[model samples]
Structures are given as C-alpha cells and as structure tokens.
Target: MAKQAKNHAHRRMTHQRQVISDCLKTLNHPTVDEIQTCVIRTAPTINKATIYRTMNRMVEDGEVIRIVGDDGAFHYDATLDAHYHMLCEECGALSDVDMPVLPQIDQYFPPDSDFRLTGHDVIFRGICSKCRAKKAGRNRAETGQN
Candidate 1:
C-alpha cells in the first residue's frame, strides 16, 4: 500500500500544484502574491503557504526560474529556454529579453584561474514604456505644457 501510494503521488501533479503551475505559465514573471491572486481564482481554498512551497519545489526541480526585481521580490518564470530578463524600475514589471546569450563570456577566465561558471543570470533594469509614458505625462502636467 505504501508503495502504491508513492507511485500514485508521482503519477501526476496535485490539483493545487497544477493550478499554481498554470498561473506561473500564464502570468508574466509573477511574484508569490500575484501567483496567489491568480491561483485563488480557480482554487479558492488554496493558501499562500501551499503556493510558496509549490513554487519553491518547482524552482528546486529546475522547472522554473526565479528572477529578482528592483523591489526585491522574487518573480517566477516557467520558460526553460535560454534568455535574460529586464525589470521596470518604475512599476516593478518584469519582462523577458530575447537577446542571444553570449557563452563566450562564461569561457573567459583570469590568468591561471580555477574558477568555473556553471551558469549565469543577467538582468537589465529600466523603466518600461508604460511607466515612461506616465512619467512624461506627469512632467508635462507639472510644466503646464498641455
């Protein structure tokens, strides 16, 4: 019976986990809070702890990548392809950067260096277009330009 239970557990994702995973896939680099909000829509009884545990497990299983924004919040992504991220400084929005990854940078080493680079994460930070537009509008209003 124990063996059967173990096998059953591995057979598929739990409904709660599936819901959380779906949220991760649908949302654009959502934080835990955002994920909870999305997950609650379908699984109203699921709580924050379960969501956090599931997301952390997914990260440990190498199924999701965690990105940190300027707000110091951990955002989750399900994209397994090689890519970088850009964070909006003004609104704390995060988006994927489709630029090619330069593997040569990982090969570069110091003289007689023993350091090794297993992987890399590069995050470019800037104000997103929406935030930029809002700032421009605020500036115009302040200056009475229109």
Candidate 2:
C-alpha cells in the first residue's frame, strides 16, 4: 500500500505538474497561455510544450476541467464538481455561479427530442462591472461634463 501511494504521489508531482497545479489553483478559469506565463515566471526552464502536456494530463486524470469559451480559447478550472460559469463578454472575466441544486429540465423536454441531457453549462454573457464603468466614463466624456 505504501509503495502504491508513493507511486501515485510520484505520478502527480513532476516539476511541470506542480507548476500547472499551482497555476490552476490561483485562478477560476485560466487559458493555457495565461497558465504558461505564470509557470514561466516560477519555472523559467519549463517550456510551453511541457505546460500544455501537463495540463492535458491533469485534465485526463480528472484533476482539472477544460472550459471552451466563445473566443475559441480553452480555460482550465481546478474545480472538479458539477457547476456553472458566467463569462463577462466585455472584460472576459469568468465567474462561478453557486446553485443549491441542479435544475430539473427533464420534465420540460420531450422523450423524442433526441437530446440526451447528460450535463449542462449555464453561462451568462454580459458586460462586467469594469466594462460598465468604462462605458459610463465614455458617456460622461461625450457629454463634456464631469
């Protein structure tokens, strides 16, 4: 048992693995490029290929989840539970939405709809607070007052 535990720990604790895990733990949803930047700061010797491979391995091992945004970029989430996310369209901010329970939509769908409800992702896309503030500033500037 000890040998097996040690082996498992070894499998999960490479230099790139540690850097990838650290990057995931620091943010809600970070893109590969973002994570690569962070990893480079800590482990300058690590390259982009190592970061990508480690992240992919982590996803395959169920240590992380990959979220594809509308921008065609893949974001990594360290949380491995069933949950939803909201993306700010203007600022590209990603946030998690808390739910007491998952909504029951099976009752609303017809049996012959051919849509299997294995899982769902509810992402609310809207302008974030910072973007709203920027728009307000622009409006003020255009009004030539304040």
Candidate 3:
C-alpha cells in the first residue's frame, strides 16, 4: 500500500508538471487565464484553481519566470534563460528581446557598495511597428500628405 501511494503521488506531480509545461510551450508569455484555457483543452478535469496553484508553485520553485506587463497583467515565461522583454504600449504585446546578457554591467553597478547583485531584468516600452504605422497613416490623412 505504501508503494502504491508513492507511485500515485509521483504520477500526480508528473501530470501537474506536464500540464504547466504544455501550456508554457504552446503559448508565449501567457496569462493565468490563457494557461487555464489551454490546459482545460487537454485535461478538462483540471480547473482554473488547479492551474493557478500549480503555476504559482512552479514560479516559487524557480521553474518559471513571472513578468508584469505594462498593463499590470502577470505573464509566465518558462524559458529559464537570461533575456529581456519588450512591451508594446499601444497593443499591450509582450515579446522576448534577443539581446546579449552582460554580466559585467551588473558588477559595474555599486562597485563599492555591499549590495550583492543576483540578476536584472530590462524592459523596453514603446510603440510597436503596427501601431506606429497606423498613427502615421492617420496623421497623413489629417494633414493631406501622401
């Protein structure tokens, strides 16, 4: 009976991990609602509460990264890699910035201070190309410019 219980526990953990992993793999920087929706498609028995609990646990365990977008929504990322994010103000889109990570920069800050730097996240906020073009077209129409 003890062996059976252990196996059941292991299987439960594996399923939970798989659900979170599948959602992360399928979506990019998805919100909790998006994850719940995706997981429900595969495991209808899993509810929003379960997804929320599992995702929160995974974030606490450092298996996932939680980023707050400009719109104040939490986005989950499972890249486990060092990278930055770009947020579009007009469209509220979150995208990964593929820039190189500079460890020296972290060391350069407060060189004489006692603050230990673990890591950093840099987010660039601006209008995306689509929004910019739309604004430009509107301006041209108003000003009678081609």
lDDT per model, in order?
0.86, 0.81, 0.86
lDDT of 2 by residue, 29-142 (tens): 998888888888888887777777888888899888888887878899998777888898876778787864356754666768778866666787888788999999999898
lDDT of 1 by residue, 1-146 (tens): 99999878765347777888888889999999999999999989888887888888999999898887777899999998879889887899999998998777776646367766577788898889999999998999989964
Task: Extract clashing residue pairs from model 3.
Answer: none
Q: What order do you get sorting by TM-score, best first?
A: 1, 2, 3
Candidate 3 residue lDDT tens string, 63-142: 99999987788899999899989998998778888889777778668878788778888889998888999999999998
Off by over 4 Å in 3: 1-6, 130-146
Q: Pick the candidate with the highest TM-score.
A: 1
Span of 10 residues, lowest total lDDT, candidate 1: 108-117
Q: Is candidate 2 or candidate 3 better by lDDT?
A: 3
- Please report how far candidate 3 places residue 51 from its true position, in Å: 1.3
Question: Which residue pairs show collisions in model 2?
Answer: none
Query: Candidate 3 at 142: error in angstroms?
Result: 8.2
Per model, state how many residue pairs clash.
0, 0, 0
